[model samples]
Target: MKRILITGANRGLGLELTRQYLERGDQVFAASRQPDAATELQELQAQYPDHLFPVTLDVTDEASINAAHAAVRAKTDGLEILINNAGIYPGASADEPTNQRLGQLTGQGAIHVMQTNALGPILVSQQFLDLLQNGVKARILSLSSGLGSLTWKSSGDPYHYSASKAALNMYMRSLAAEVGHYGIISVLVDPGWVRTGMGGSGATLPPSDSARGIIRIADQLHTEENGSFLTWQGQPVPW
Candidate 1:
């Protein structure tokens, strides 16, 4: 079984991905900001005591990322999959068109969102590179969004969120080139408009469906697929 590490595992898509991974008998390191308070994750830990490891990690903080890496190192010698799923999409309500618009977006809010959604994955991946190198058919999968695609940007106003995800897509593409020599496949996955805290009530896809599709795509990832942006259903998304 593969050893997988999923960030933001407390709720929504991350939690669902953790559940699906454990169900397939893979060892999972479920990292979240508040591990103890994640009731759903705790329940899963109870069910898969031998395979599920709850880890405390704040992707935006370097100290937390280092500490979480240490914790994972203590438990497993290698990690075959690292899903950088921790991210934030903050702005005005989808129904409301207030602060999130072009000129109205706050600099502070945009910076914070960029740090969490784009920079966090890069930092976390760097810390875990060694472990990933030792793994069997290692792959780094960063959760991106269709909103990030410049070609797909038709209409929407989440300025900060969209910009950050676009930046993330670029970073992962660069990382793929850097890590290709090490035989690590780096991919950016756009899990459609999944119904989560960020996706809101109007979203069409459920977390379970998105998670399942993402897992299927990740499992089939190969060197040829590296540095590509794809949907949860394995459709190629324009960069």
Candidate 2:
């Protein structure tokens, strides 16, 4: 079984992904801001005590990232998969979004979103690179969004969220170019609009379906697919 690390595992898509992976018998390191307080994770741990490892992490901080890396390192020498799933999309649930609008965009708000959505994944991947190299068929998959695609982007809404995801896509692709020779696959996976807090209640897809699709994509990836941007369904997404 693969040793996998999933960030933002307290709820939504991250939690689903963790559950599915554990069901497949993989050892999962579930990372969250307050992992001890996550009741779902606690329940999962009770069910799969050996496989579910909770990691406390604050994605926006360097010290937290380092500590998280250490926590994972203490248990395993390598990590076969690293899913950078932790992210925030502010104002997605708001009925009247003030910060996401064009005129209402504030630098402070945008930076906060960027720190979590874009910078956090990069830092986590950077810290985990060595363990990934020692892993068996290692890969790095970051959760991106359709809004990140310039070609697919049609709306002017949620400027900060969209921009941060776009940055994440580019960062992961560039990282792939540098690390692919090491036999580590790096790609961005888009989970699509789901019925999560970020996706709101109107989204069509279910978290289970998306999470299943992502695990399939992660397992099937080859070196040639290292820099691709794909849907959870494993279909290529336009740049």
Candidate 3:
């Protein structure tokens, strides 16, 4: 069975992805910021027993990320797939009645969002580089969003979310270029507007459905696709 690691596994898409992968009999490292309070994930661990492992990971903290990486490395020599799925979108949406503008966005909120959404994945990916390199079919997947597309932003929409994702895309592209020689398949994936905490209530797709599409694309990544920005359904997303 393929071994996979995913962050933010306490809820939503990350939770669903863990369930789906575990159902397929794959080894899953389900990570969350607060594993002790993640009753659902803990229950999953109880059900899967040997198939699922629970880990505590706070991607925003450098020391925490390193510690999590070390714990995983001790248990397994390599991982078949690594999904950097933890992120945050602070404040209300731009269209909301209580929405805050760029000027009104609190310094703390903006910094937290950027650190979690952009810098977190880059540092986490770097920490696990050696583990991925040990796999025969190594793959690194960063859960980006369509809001990150520069082309879409040029059309004017979703400013804060778009800007954060765009920055994430840029970092992923650079990382892919730097690590491609290791035979690792690295790409930034836009999972579409799925129904989750971050995706909000009006989202068209369910988290399970979106995870299905994402896992499909992730499983089929090839060397030629390195540094490519792609959608859940394998479509190219302009960066």
Question: Which one is best on lDDT?
Answer: 2
Task: Please list the residue runs of candidate 3 whose C-alpha ends up more than 4 Å from where it truly belongs after superposition.
Answer: 92-100, 154-158
* Candidates, ranked, lDDT: 2, 1, 3
Better of 1 and 3 by lDDT: 1
Give me candidate 1's TM-score against the actual structure: 0.96
Cα displacement (Å) at residue 67, model 3:
0.7
Which pairs clash in model 2? none
lDDT-best of 2 and 3: 2
Model 2: CA > 4 A from native: 95-98
Root mean square deviation (Cα) for candidate 3: 2.3
Residue 145, candidate 3: how far off, in angstroms? 1.1
**Residue range 1-239, candidate 3, lDDT tens digits:** 88899999999899999999999999998888898899999899999999898888999999999999988987899998999899876543545432225446555655667788899999999999999898778888999987787676654334555667888898989999988988898899888888887788898989988899889988888899999989888999877
Q: TM-score, each model? A: 0.96, 0.98, 0.93
lDDT per residue for candidate 2 within 1-239, as digits (tens), equals: 99999999999999999999999899999999999899999999999999999999999999999999999999999999999999988776666454978889999999999999999999999999999999999999999999999999999988999999999999999999988989999999999898888788999999999998999999999778989999999999998
TM-score, candidate number 2? 0.98
